[model samples]
Target: MKPVDDDVLLTEVQFKELFRDQSAIERYMSGPHPLVLGHRVIRDNRFLVKISPDNLTAFKKEYPHDPIVDLLTTPYWFRVHVYYDIVTSEDFVVLTHGKPGISDLPVVRIHSESLFNRFPLRTVGNRTSSRSR
Candidate 1:
């Protein structure tokens, strides 16, 4: 991430406008829900989702793959993960499978929003936070 330009400043109105633009971009990029960081267990399998700077650093140490993690969200082992060119906006669960060295495990990346949007399901929304799932 690049440092903020200290020399640059914005008025309150400009800041608010920027904030709104950012929110729209995030929603369009990620989906309806906002991003959150944490770990969860789905269907008795362990998952670790790291998107925050601190957590990404920690995940990088073990997995050595920054900005990418996978989740096996189905009984048939369908893999899913957050997708972004530089950083992830979509919320996803990274299934650890009760093991270490997450990068060692084979996975296929899927943009959660795209998946849900492209194939709208009766129960599935555009995108869901891991906690909600």
Candidate 2:
């Protein structure tokens, strides 16, 4: 995620005050932080979030560290990872932000690919960092 120069972005002091012991900045600087990095620029690194009625809750719980969630809780902001389209090779992703007007029904969005910009889920030891059904 690109760092913002304006005060509109979260402040370090505010983060410290809010999280107290959180190490978001450190995690962001190191590797592919799930919260900061978006979908991979290629065909593989797409953050494939299969949304459904059952798995949606679990997904949100699992990615509590996701900054997009934080942004959504506030106003005027949300997170969307662009993916690559297989046919046209366009940049896209099903993006959502701000308050939802309805409690049911999911929206349709486009997905495209980026050759260089991507966030492949990391593998730790024997398990994959990505969650899939």
- What number of backbone clashes does candidate 1 have, counting pairs of residues 3 or more apart or in separate chains? 0
Q: Write the per-residue lDDT of candidate 1 for residues 1-133, one digit (tens) a residue.
A: 1212211122233334433545542532353332323323322322233234444344446765422322111122223344444254444555322232534433333334433345445675535644346
User: In model 2, which range of ten residues has the least summed lDDT?
Assistant: 42-51
Best by lDDT: 2
lDDT of each: 0.35, 0.38
lDDT of 2 at 7: 14
| Segments in model 1 whose C-alpha atoms lie over 4 Å from true places | 1-36, 54-133
**Candidate 2 Cα misplacement greater than 4 A, ranges:** 1-8, 18-23, 37-59, 63-68, 76-133
- The best candidate in terms of TM-score: 2
Q: How close is candidate 2 to the true structure, as a TM-score?
A: 0.23
Task: Report the C-alpha lDDT of model 2 over 1-133, residue by residue, as the tens digit.
Answer: 3223211233334445443553743443344333333211212211221112233245468777654344423443456665666675455555564334444333343444343424443544424212221
